[model samples]
Target: MTSHPTVGHVHLRVADLDRAIAFYRDILGFDVTQQSATAAFLGAGGYHHHIGLNTWDSLNASPPPAGHTGLYHSAFLYPDRASLGTVLCRVAAAGITLDGAADHGVSEAVYLRDPDGNGVELYRDKPQAEWPRNPDGKLAMINARLDVQAIMDEAP
Candidate 1:
């Protein structure tokens, strides 16, 4: 069996396909690789698609109520801190408000909601050697504050 398979794509049901496209394409800098009247495929660095947005059944539908069982968030990993910071700048320029930012020992992440209210996490992982571990060598992930301003300052 193949070990350590990577997640290749995430397909989302959005309320307004155009609005979702604006957020993912215009704001987040993904390329619109394909699109239909009610669907879109977005990718970065060009490999088919990383995210698919469709409104087949969710057209004009409302977001799920709080305290419901569903996707908590879909995380998009960046290659480095500078890349993540560039995204932060784009997000700010788009006037989208962030839910929060955090340092999770091995990663720095910023959280926000999409136009359809789905949670999105933008993050960059630290080097494997920098990961925190307990005395027994188990990973010790911590939820700590991230200095977002400092991160933004590193944007290219």
Candidate 2:
């Protein structure tokens, strides 16, 4: 059997190149390393790009209608719970509403929508040993409300 591929980068067709850059760069803290008239590349920690935004066909396009099968959500994993709390506070201060926040047994996640209505998940994974497992030794992920205050208390 062939090995599955790791995710390289996520490329999106955006309605406006500069606007998308601002959301990813100014808001999400991605660094813009490359740009053309139509394509832009963004990265964090200066290791090339983790995301690419292009306005090829979506130059003035609106978001896909609800119930579409594309892009359920893209998760951005934070380094720690404090970072997660910081992001949560930033999102709150920006007046962006969360779709949900959950403690998923293995991770704590906060869900929101990007400027283009794309779902985004910001999360931090719990240690492997702390994750719950079923009787069969498979992961037993449960979605319950996350204690936001407790997490923020961990923030420096």
Q: TM-score of each candidate?
A: 0.96, 0.91
For model 1, how does the per-residue alpha-carbon lDDT over 37-121 read when each residue is reduced to its tens digit? Answer: 9999999997899999999999999999999999999999889998999999999988889999999999999999999999999
Cα lDDT tens digits, model 2, 88-138, are 777777788889889999999988988888888889999999999999999
Name the lDDT value of residue 121 in candidate 2. Answer: 88
Clash statistics: count for each candidate: 0, 0
Question: Which predicted model would earn the best lDDT?
Answer: 1
Give candidate 2's error at residue 109 in angstroms. Answer: 0.5
Which residue pairs collide, candidate 1?
A: none
lDDT for each candidate structure: 0.94, 0.87
